[model samples]
Target: MTRKAAGNAPGHAAGNEAGEETGEEPGEEPGAAHWLFGDQLGPHFIDPARGGPRRDAPLLMIEARSVLRRRRFHRAKAHLILSAMRHRAAELGDRVRYVKADTYRQGLREAVGDARVTVHHPTSHAALAFVRSLPSVRVLSARGFLVTHDAFGRWADGRGTKHLRQEDFYRWVRQTHDLLMEGDQPAGGRWNLDHDNRQPPPRGATDLGVPAPYRPRESEIDDEVRADLDRWSRDGDVEFVGEDGPRGFPATRREALAALHRFIEHRLPTFGAYEDAVLTGDATMSHSLLSSSLNLGLLDPAECAERAEAAWRSGDVPLNSAEGFVRQITGWREYVWHVYWHFGTRYRESNTLGHHEPLPDWFTDLSPDGTDANCLSHVLRQVRDTGWTHHIPRLMILGSLALQRGWEPGAVTDWFHRSFVDGYDWVMVPNVVGMSQYADGGRMTTKPYTSGGAYINRMSDFCGPCRYKPTVRVGEDACPFTAGYWNLLHHHRDRFEHNPRMTQAVRGLDRLTDLEALLEQERDRRD
Candidate 1:
């Protein structure tokens, strides 16, 4: 007879150090452990040894699908979840049991027979209707931060408090952990040293750090990636940007870290200073290429923060590097989240200037022999060629184009998402609309970051062969950005012109009495 077990220490328990669960359910009886299959089986798999209603044994269940699409895509998420669950099950040994039902109704049918089954996968609404419809059953909201809505365990304490917005919530996190607050009590006493660090380059050639790419060395990952790529090959236009000359790259956590370590050591010091500047043959532009790692949750936030901060504390890196890195990890990243939740789903729909143009074809189509090439064409081509656009191009070129041309924020927002590998809702939203578009009523950033083509002309060699001249505004060959520069000012004059910081530029435009007329010519160029 298989013996059941009580609680084994699992890393899922908050205070428990991160590692594998140690399952040793003493006094657990056989046949006590029970597993319920939710609509979606979560990352953690259940143990079959000691699952039951006893103290040592507990119910385990899988969750349902968040949404259904008839076309099934191979879920890398599923593989990870299943692997974690199996690892947990091995750790917990006993009479632990689970369901193999395909549909929620079947799982529920089994759940009905076993009063010990606490977890469930209600595939159909009717399944849940039936289960909760019965007596001695109850439902409660989840306590995890991932909760979309509050049920019984809801906390209203956030209302009208420090949690009123994400900046406040992030500040709370900073203070709680003493990150960049003030004085010796703070972790470095400097909120930010970015201003000093963000320098333009002198006349010299720069070196490119070796890009960290990987082949799937882990046998399980390699085999599964091959299978999954084959399965997903027909989905959209999936490019296999991998080693061995495949364009696809690392799709797992282990390889992501290798990319990160190389950045921290080779690129982080110069990141903030030239993080925005773009140059020829400079694929990464002194930026730490760890955005995807942190976003995918492969790297824990606190741990990364501690590692970067610790490096600074040990005198391994300067304060500018440390604070600049912290701002990316702690300040801006957290702010992006708060802005999204505060703004809500419709935030993406904003069109501050009511522009209805499609994203410039330069975003999708490239021309080998055309002269009407967009001012942004060179930069958009950058992303298309390498799935990357450094900060300045994103903010100045793309953002400026959208704002000046009056494209719907949503249209440009979608463009931002599709063009980059790191484009997720949380990060991209604030970046696109707020920093990029200034569409969020100017909450995330104070000023619209726009400029004539000279800014790019000065920083990059791209201007030499660009279809339009940065200096010419009225001619057919003029950079549209230069002409649009004046039009944007005239268009938004009342709202922004009088502001002290912006008025200087507006006054400069006023001096060119024919500015409005030249601006009109610029609009014609877009056609």
Candidate 2:
């Protein structure tokens, strides 16, 4: 629950008695007046304004889990959370129950009766805020990252706010549970082998281990969500992608553990080199698709990293693969979450570079024409279809292009949030807008990562059939990505010019001029 230190500020939106938005404004502080928590905002922060519990009746609340990807399952977390709520409410035979973010508003408390009502939360943040909102209602934390009230800034010490440089919290997680960190050194002889696993996978390699997917049958509440999703589609374009099985998700801890083990033994070996490599139909790279489970509290971060460490120790996977995977969990993933919250809602709105370029059309298209050669058409297709993209394409290509083109950091974050299956507000805001876009002034990553076609070609097979050539740096056949990379450095030379690690890239840029217009023509018209 948010502490009510109500000192009215200038830009705080004023909440009216009748009916107006009640949320933190885009440019305003998050006060009780004008902030309207609604559809467009993340589902995590959509509940009642932070207050306390309610004085009501009937103590049954249900949380149904669903993954909404306009891509495969017409999947939306909205469907799962609300559907489970509905099913549980119906099972208990209660009408005063059932709170769905998809179909309800924040006024549930004001409108509900004396009997205690139930509200469904798609994420831990939503649940925490919901509990904080009620006066006499029950509260529950998600099995996963639902830590809202207890704002645990792992990076922050007793001091004001601290930047998490080392893997302290992650180390504690390993030490506390006695995970993979084992050896004469710490837990193991070494802490991580991420740096060791950088060797590229054997080219033209096809040792991809088969990945299993679960598609569950629609249970009781799914009918309601399906109905809502169908209705939603009539208004615009919402595709339906669902799994076909009994209970689609890995409901318990065991299934999630199995998923992790599979990655450790089979996938971890090749994860690092190919972590950035994209291939057609290779949805799950050597990487483990465990973010959803981790976010939902289905798996522990320490446990996950340790398992990868175990893979390396057992020789099931290489050190580089293990270390790289561990870095994603310990370094990147947690760092992004911390940065997002530290920056707060404003993090998503940051545009420190002042770039207003719209995201390129290729971002929303299927073909590779006029697209950045290092781009992932499939991943972009996935984003548009299901709201999800794999890490490499999302980070390297998508993020790289955004940095190169000078798109508003906020817009890029929104695209990632709106279009990814795993796009939680805490995660997406920082990674996309702050880290990848460098809108946060190098908070999470080393630099803006403004790269071009050459980087893409080095990592993936997506460029082979691409409309443009990755090799060409100028003129018609020149890959837009190639020129874009140089142009980004050229345009932002003063910024990245002195960056020591960026020196090599700056040297590469030395060949190009500040003529971004000509660069654009070289890329855009390259047939």
Candidate 3:
């Protein structure tokens, strides 16, 4: 039997238990209905005035199977989200309704019964569209993000018709928030410490040990989730990848806080230096694995940034490390969210490059190791095993490879959405379709992030054991990335001729003696 939260309110019931139908009709009572999305589980939503649980409001949590069926989500990602929602409802104690339905719209209709409902604006575009379509529901602005919509709009208005750059926006956020700032200027006299970061992995660094993975202890909830997933797999009702093991992330607010503290003490110092480094065996290399919790609303982004800033002030960590950490939360995180809302739905469909190749089969499944390319295979293995790899690998390896090979932007975006534990529509679209793929025609990013194998060799250890040579651009032993790099330049040479950033690389392409033969060889290898 499916377990439900106990001790519900006197007038209400948990799950499908019988309760009074007094508020079943619309316009019957005030503050009678409130629904929460998976990402909006913070206590602030309960009582906005006092920031506590609302004892009188009827809370609803829905497990929508339609969302799961929309994409083949990682097994661990599904478990993490579902289990967290269940745990939140159980913790709320009373006046809570939890339902499992095929679609969110159906679930919301069932929960509301006949009462008028109020829903906070969702972080995702699809959810927002769904909530707006319901006649009985009223949508309110969401409360979790650090920057408000009005604030973001005002910032955008200041930019006028010109595209807003991340660096300028990042500085504005720092100055407005007074974080790591002295009066009107940055604390370190520099707005960015990015130059100090990006050091390659240190030799013999593997011997120093990596942070232990955050695997929560087994619970009844975990057992139930695992059973459900296994049943789905056996019955062929759902398709998911990755092993459904102990949830490798903190699910509750208290646990999230603990994880944050652990990261500050253990990983924050070296996070800046090795943030871009990619090693073969080590996945979590001095990087704060708090994005999942922050995105889920278990931890506030502002508070996390403030904590890192405080660490810098205390002299516990270097300015570069603290600044880098803070920049991610307050800068990139806020910027992307604003871009997603400002651009609206059409932003997702941007495909300026006009590339239309489907993603390779090896990306979806890595069983028996399909590819001979070590960098691709190792990174895919990390994702398949843990449902995550740091941003560097995402941008430099997986994303760059897709861009070089001219893969379909939507296909690449969908793969990212399904693969990561923290993947969401708002987060993936801007990062994948815009920044990583440059499919948005330099709207979100200044240029395409395409790179050769030399970059990979410089930043990572993946090239050392690879079968192909990183330096070769053609012939049988040529690294696919190197060959693909030249091919990509040749493909988009005319378009990027006027681009200042590509001028040097474009000029280098003229130096190729046998460009057509190299392109032909690359095509054959792909086929």
Candidate 4:
């Protein structure tokens, strides 16, 4: 059903024998190279020398309805992915064949027919499995990642895997990649500058400069996506959450680069210090907000790390700032991807703490004023409107609250995968299920990322504006997080008593004279 592009680039993989017998009939063209939805516009799609798609090679893209139906994705997330794919396809012109199919496998089958197909290995395990199952499909290694899976596996093998610490892996990455390194030692003399980066949100309005929100210029592609979404809503059974504002995220390479430069110039200087701060009205707060672009392959991870390192070496940005930023992409980002692949599908099913409560109703509510908790409501408002929030709010606020409430790990993981614009299975599974939820039994994290309202109070301005008291353990006006926190510790006392890192928190449980009363109060509130 797809037409072949005329002529071939010099040294093209397929060459002039486009109609050669690669499991096809006479005069039938060979299978087109299929780029999945998440494999949007990238270096791989443009430059053949860089293992990119050939200009003469037919390109296939499928907007699989199955994926949309799999979860209630944020409207902005859907728009971002779909629009970006369409935009890239249009940029590729007649060489591309875009199909809207009911399922990915069905789409690929239809696109290739009897011809032998070649596919880039997907980041998601599920997608990879699906591609591998196809008889005619040939899988190629996925590009755009800083570290290869085999290399990470080899590193993990050498480390021996007892307690897989990100710090150790991070150092290995730095030494191997030579990022932010001065000879053999790190540039700042210390491997981690995380301590320097832990300053709380700056007080007073004077320090809070004009919010430089990244509002990408709208194009015809966005209008085309908006129309598709409108039509889908009317005709399809698929449900979507969150808003689709035009001023949200950049879906094109040009806009992504602009956003990157904007972050380097404006945010990188203070990014490390304020990285964990959650302000009342400020959602971005010196954050790069480039994860979606980076994950989508619009920005290269190495380039991002090098740019930040350059800023630091030039004395334009601090070592803490630059090192912290580089660690995220080269360290944590690389680690998570490795963990996701290493652990396999079983990783998603892990529930060490056995959390089974349903997710709160307010998580998907379209209204900005979804809950009474000021901090949570603010973060959700940002996510619902823009499909993005800084990592602090994600981990400390949303993840902590859910962990305290004992929400089901799988449900929480799925919510994260659906909610965020940057979220993909490879990123969310290890992060939400393992790190945030501690559902994987501390495989991804050293401990459950749980905290009472006190931590939030110290780290952010959230507690001041909140209706509940951050310090109060139990009462009518006691913070839900505080109550839930005490309950969490009390419930897990036996398991945590031997853990040195958790000994202090476990010991605090002994100080509560009215422990039963507090637990009962929290239970009643939860009910």
What order do candidates take by lDDT, descending? 3, 4, 2, 1
Model 3 spans > 4 angstroms off:
1-29, 50-55, 158-162, 207-210, 366-368
lDDT of 4 by residue, 158-214 (tens): 555446789988888787777888888989699999998888877754244634856
lDDT of 3 by residue, 181-267 (tens): 877889889999888898888875552265664556656887888898889888888989876666888778877888888888777
| Clash list (residue pairs), candidate 4 | none
Query: lDDT of each model, Cα atoms only?
Result: 0.51, 0.52, 0.77, 0.77
Pick the lDDT winner.
3
Worst 10 residues of 1 by lDDT: 10-19
For residues 54-75, write the lDDT of model 2, one tens digit per residue.
2222333322222233232325
Q: What is the TM-score of each candidate against the true structure?
A: 0.67, 0.70, 0.92, 0.91
User: Candidate 3 — what's its lDDT?
Assistant: 0.77
- lDDT for model 1, on a 0 to 1 scale? 0.51
- Model 3 — TM-score against the truth? 0.92
The digit string of per-residue lDDT tens for model 1 on 1-527 reads 11111112111111111111223232333344344332122222232222213444455443222211221222332333333333333334353334434444455456445453343223223344555665433322111111111110122144532234434444444554555545434455545465676555444544434343332343454454445445645563243321221223234455556666666666666666665566665656667756644544445444455566666776776667766776677567655654555555666766565567775543434222332544366665555455556677788777887787877787677656545555555567778887777676555565678888888777665676677889877666768777777788777888677666687888777677667669668666567
TM-score of 2: 0.70
Q: How far is each candidate from the true structure, as Cα RMSD in Å?
A: 9.3, 9.7, 7.7, 6.7
